[model samples]
Target: MEARVEVSPEQEARRIAAVRRYDILDTPPDGAFDRIAALAARLFDVPVATVTIVDTDRVWFKAAYGLAGVTQVGRDPGLSTSAILTDGPLVVPDTLQDPLARDHTLVTGETRARFYAAAPIVTRDGHRLGTVDVMDTRPRRTTPEQAGALADLAALVMDELELRLTALRMLRVERELVVVEHAARERAERDRAEIAAYAATLQRTLLPPALPEVPGLEAACHYTTASVRDVGGDFYDVFPLGTGRWAFFLGDVSGRGAPAAALTSLIRYTLRSTALLQPDPCAVLRALNAALLSESADGSRFCTLIFGTLVPHPAGGFAITLTGGGHLPAYRLHPARRDGPSQALARAEPVSLPGGMLVGALRQADFTSRPVRLLPGQALFLYSDGLIEARTSRGARFGEESLAAHLTHHAATNRALGAAAIIDDLTVLLDSFAAGPADDVALLALSAATATPTTAPSGASGTAHTSLPLPARHSM
Candidate 1:
C-alpha cells in the first residue's frame, strides 16, 4: 500500500518565498563577489553567509562564509536569482515577521532566525552576480561605527571585481596577437611562391625556344642565365631574312634581372629586325646602338654585342663578316693539322666594330667589321664576358687560353654535341678554378662544308702543241 503524502499550508507558503531569492546566472565571476560575502558575515557576526551566483533552479556561491562545498544551496530553500532584485538591502527585520516563519525549519519555531541581511552583488559593468547574504538567530542593529565598517568592506569587494575583469581582457589580447602572427606568415609564403612562378615565365621569354635555320650554314648555340631568379639582361638570336643572307647576334647588358631582361629583349628583336633590313654587319650594330640610345630614359643602361653575316666564300668556304661593339672577342678553332695543337683565331686584336657603342650609353657610336673564312671542318665561336671573366678558384679569370684549348679539342665534334660538351667542361673547369662562374654564360658556334673540284696545272695548256709537232717530225 502507498503511503499518502500531504502538504501543510504554512510549510508551502515559506517554500514559495524561498524560491524567489536571486536572479543571476551564467556570468563571469569577480573578486568583488568574495569580498561582499565575507563582509556580510563579519558585519552581522553571523556564522553563515554567501555571495551566490544564481542559475535557473539553484544558486552557486562564488565565495562563502562558514560553508564548504555547500553547493546544494538552500536545499530547495531559496533560489538566488530572485535575490538580485530589491534595490535596498533585504533586511529580515525579524524572522517572526515572516507569515510562514514557523514552517521555515531553519527559523520559525526552533533556532528562530531573528536576523538577516543581503546586499546585491554588483559587477564592474553593473550586472549582478547574486547577493551578499548573512543570517543570525537573534535580532540586532548596530551603531554608526558598525555601519561605516560594513561599507568599507563592501568597497573592497568592488575592487576585486575590477581586478578579475582586467585579467579577462589580458587573455583576449594575447589570443589576438597569435592570430595576427599566423596571418602574416601565410602572406609571406604566398609572396615567395608568386615570385618563383614569375621567374620561370621571364626566363622562357628571354631566350628563343629553338635555333633558326640558315641554308649552307650549320649552326649551334647555347644560353643560360645565372639563375632563374629575377629577369636577366643577356640574350642571343639567329634568324633568316627574306633575302638569302642570315643574321646572328649575341649581346650582354650590364646588369641582371627585370631591367636587364627588358633590355635584352629589346636587343633581341632590334638586332634581328635591323639585320633583316640592312644585312651589313656594321650597319646593323650601328642601328642597334642608335635605337637603344633613343629609347633609353636614364641613359645609364647599355649593351655590348657582336653581329654577323653569313655568305659563301669563293675559295670553297663560308666568309663570315663580324662586327664588334665593344664585345668580348669571338674565337675560331681550325682542325689540328701540321699546325701543333689547334689554336684560337679572332684577329690580332678586337676587330674595330666602329660606329657602335654600348646601345644606351651614347647616341652616336661606331662599329667595325672583320671577315674570317670559316673553311670546311672548321668552327666559329662568339661568347659573352660571363665566360672569360668567370672567376676561378684562386680568384683569377678563366681567360681566353682555357676556352681556346677546349674549342680545339671539341670543335670537330657535331655542332650540337660539341657546344654542350664545351659548356659542361667549362662548368667543371669553373668549379675547379673558382667556386663557380659568378655570371651567366652565352656561347654560339657555326660550322659548314663546301665541295670543291681538283684543278690541273695552269702552265700546261701552252706547251701541249709544241710537244706533239716535235714527236711527228721525228717519226717521219
Candidate 2:
C-alpha cells in the first residue's frame, strides 16, 4: 500500500490566496526572474532551475533556465510542494531513492530527477508564495552555502514584486496631481483678467477728464502709467479757486495700486478745498499736511507735493507763489536769445522753495513759499521724480542734468515754447529714453499766452472755475 500524503486544508487555502495576490502565475518570463534562475542553475551545477509558483492543482514556472519547452508540472507531494507546505527550504538527494518522492512522476517518469532543492519565497506576513528551485538528473547533495544562496534568490524575487506594486501606486498618484494643478491654473487666470479690467476703469475716474484753461495762461498736462494692470500714485490738476486766482497742484503718493489711488484722490480734493478756504500757497500746504498726518496712523502712507496759487499781475505776467513739501524743484524755461550768427541759447532756472517735511508723516509740518514770475514766451515745468529717475538702455539715469539739457534744447529750438509744446516734446523724449518706464510720471506745464485771446480761460475750455464743496471731516 502507498503511504498516505498529509494535507492541511485551512493552511493550503491561505497559502494559495497569498500566491494569487502576487498575480505572478502563468505570466510571461521576465528578465529579472529569468536571470536569477539562470544564476541558480550555474551556481548549483544543475541542468534545470526555475522560479515556480504553486497553484491549486499544478505548479507554474514564472521563469525557467536550462529546461525543455515545459511551462508547468503536476504539484506532487514532493520537494517543491514540501517547501511551499512547510514554508521552509527542502532538499532531496536521489529523489527516486527518497520516500517523499518515491511515487512522484519526476522520479518515476522519463524526466527522472534524482536531486532537488528549493527555498520558499516568503512574504513579510509569513506567507510562503513560491519557490526558487534547482533540479538535476544525477543524484547530488547540497552544501550549506548553496542552500543559503537559493533562499537569498527567493527573497530577491519577492522584492521585485513589491517594487512593481509600489511603482503602480506612485504612477496613479502623479496622474491625479496633474489634473488638480491644471484646474487651479485656469481659475487663477480668469481672476487676473477681471482684476485688470476693474483697475483700468478706476484709474480713469481719478484723473481730470481734461486740463482746465487758466485765464491769460496756457496749460497742459500728461500722465503715463507704468502698467495697465495697476493704478499709479502720481496725480495732477489745474482748477480755479475764485476771485481771478487759480490753484494747481501735482503730487506723488508713496505706493502703487488701489491704496495709492485712494490717497491720490484724497490729496487732490483736499488741496482744492483748502486752496479755496485759504488761497495762500503756504497756508494751503500746511492744512494738507495736517489732514495727511491725521489719516496716516499706520505711517506707511505719505506724499511729496508742490501746491501753488496763480494771481494775475497788473503787469503782463502772472505772479506765481509755490510751496514745496519734499518735492523736486520746478524749472522755469526762458526764451531763446541769439548767441551768434547761427546759434541760439536758452536757460533753465530752478525755482527753489524752502525744504519742508513730506505730507502725511508728521504731527506738525512746516511749509514755505517762493514767489516767481511766469512771463509770455517762457514756460514753467512741474514733474514727478519718475521723469528724472528713468534709465537709458545702457543703464544711465536721466538725472537732473539730463532733464535740464532737454529743457534748454527745446527752449532754444522753439523760442516761444508754449505749455502744449513743452509737454509734447518731453513725452517724446521720455519714450525714446526708456522703452518701458519704471514708475508713474505726472507732468504739468504752464505758460503765459503770447497772443491775447477773446475768451477768458474757463471750465468750457477744459478748465473748471466753479466753487467745489468742502471735504467732509473724518476721524483718523
Candidate 3:
C-alpha cells in the first residue's frame, strides 16, 4: 500500500494564495486551456478530463471535457482536491481498491469513477494550485509515458497562466497611466484639439503624399473627413510596378483610431510588397488575405478593397484589370460619340465583378477580376462607401442612382473635365452637405488625357492637371 501524503497548514494557505494570484478563477473559459483539457482526455482514453483550481470551499473547473454542466464540487470529497494534496502525479488504477480515494464521494456517489490520474499544476515556486486530471468509469492502468504526458500538460497550463498574468499586469499599468493623464489635463478643449491633430497626422502617414504620374494616364485623388475628432479608416494609393505596369488600390478598414491606422499600414505594406513579387490582381489580394488571417487569427480586422493593374495598350490608352473584395462598384464614364462638332455625355456604366467575397473573412474566399479598356476622354471613378451612404441636405441618403445622375450631369457640363476636375467637383459637393459627410470620403479617378480641349468649361482652367494637394481634412 502507498503511504498517503499530507500538506501542512502553512502550505495549504500558500496554495490558496497562489490560486488567487493567478486571477483565473470564475473567469470566462479560455480556448487554449479548453483545447488542452480535450487533448488530455483523448491521450489517456478517459471519459472525463478537466483543468481545475482547488479553492477553499470548492473545486472549480476552469476547463472540462465530457463533464457537461458541472462547474464545481465540494472541496473535501473532490478528486481535484485530493490530487493537489500530493507533489506528483497520483494514479489510482481502481478507485474502489485505493485506501485514500475509495470512500471519496465521487467514487461512492453517481460518478462511479473507477480509474483516475492527475498531475498537480504547480507554479515555479512549488505552490500547487490545481490539477490536470482524467477519470474513467472502468478500471485501467497507465504506462510511464502516459503519466509523463499528463505532467507536461500541467506544465503547459502553468505557462499559459503566467503569460495571462503578465498581460493583465501590463494592462493595469496602462490604465493607471491613462487615469493620471486624465487628471492632469484640466482644459477639455485643448485635449480635444490635440487628439484631432494627432489623428490627422497619423492618417496622412497612411497614404501617399501625391498620386504617382502614370505615363498616358492621368490620376487624381481627394480625401474628406466627416469629423476631425475621430480617426477614419479610408485609405488609397497608386504606385508603379517597374514592369511597364502600375498598381492602385482604394479601401476602408474595419475600425477607427490607432487599431485602424495600424491595420491600414499593414494592409498597404502587404499589398505593395506582395504585388511586386506576384502582380496578378487576384493573387496579390490572396497574399494579403493570408497575411491578414495570419496576423489576426480572431478575425477582428478586415477591409473592403479594389485592387487593379494598369498596362499601356498598343491600340490607344491603358488596359486595366480590377479585382474587388467586398467593395463598392466602380463607374466608367464614356464621352459622347461625335457625329458632328457637338459633344454630349454618355451614361455611366457600373462594373460588375462576380465571385468577389469579403477578404480576410474566410480562408477559402474567392476574388474575381474584370478587364476594361480606357479610351481617350474616358475615366474610371472609384469612391468609398462614405460617398453613397452620406446623408444629403434633404435628410435622404445620397444613394448610387443619385450619385450616377450627378456624375453624368457634371461630365456633360464640363467639357474639359479630366481626372482632377472630376475629383474637384466631388470635393465641392461633399463640402456643401449640411452635416458634411457622415463618414470619411475618398475619391480616386483615372482618365486618359485628351490631346486638346475643345472648349474650357466656365470654372475650368487651361487644362486639368493630376497634381493635387496632400490629404487634408476638408470637412468644416
In terms of lDDT, the best-performing candidate is 3
Q: Could you say which candidate leads in TM-score?
A: 3
lDDT of 2: 0.74
Q: Please identify which of the two predictions, 1 or 3, would achieve the higher lDDT against the true structure.
A: 3
User: CA lDDT of 281 in candidate 3?
Assistant: 92
Q: Return the TM-score for candidate 2, rounded to 2 decimals.
A: 0.55
Off by over 4 Å in 2: 1-186, 338-344, 451-476
Error of 3 at 159 (Å): 40
lDDT tens string, model 3, 325-421?
9999998887666657775557677886867977787788899999999876788899999999888889899999999998888767765448887
What is the C-alpha lDDT profile of model 2 across 72-185, one tens digit per residue? 879887766777765456888888777877777766876678898888888888777778989899988888777877776787677666654544444455446545655757
- Per-residue accuracy of model 1 over 1-476 as CA lDDT, tens digit each: 01212435564344334323222233444333543565467656787776665444556666777665454344234223334544434555575664533344446433355765555555544444455667777776554444434433443444344433443444455446545655767877555544544554555556665666554455655554555445556677676654456667787887776778667766765665445446577777776676677667566778888888777666655777888887877776555443367554322122345555565676666677888777765556777876787766677887877666656556444332223344455445544643444566777766554343123211111100000112112111
Candidate 3 has a TM-score of 0.57
lDDT of 2 at 93: 83
For each candidate, the alpha-carbon lDDT, in order, equals: 0.56, 0.74, 0.78
Order of candidate numbers by TM-score, starting with the best: 3, 2, 1
- Candidates in order, TM-scores: namely 0.49, 0.55, 0.57
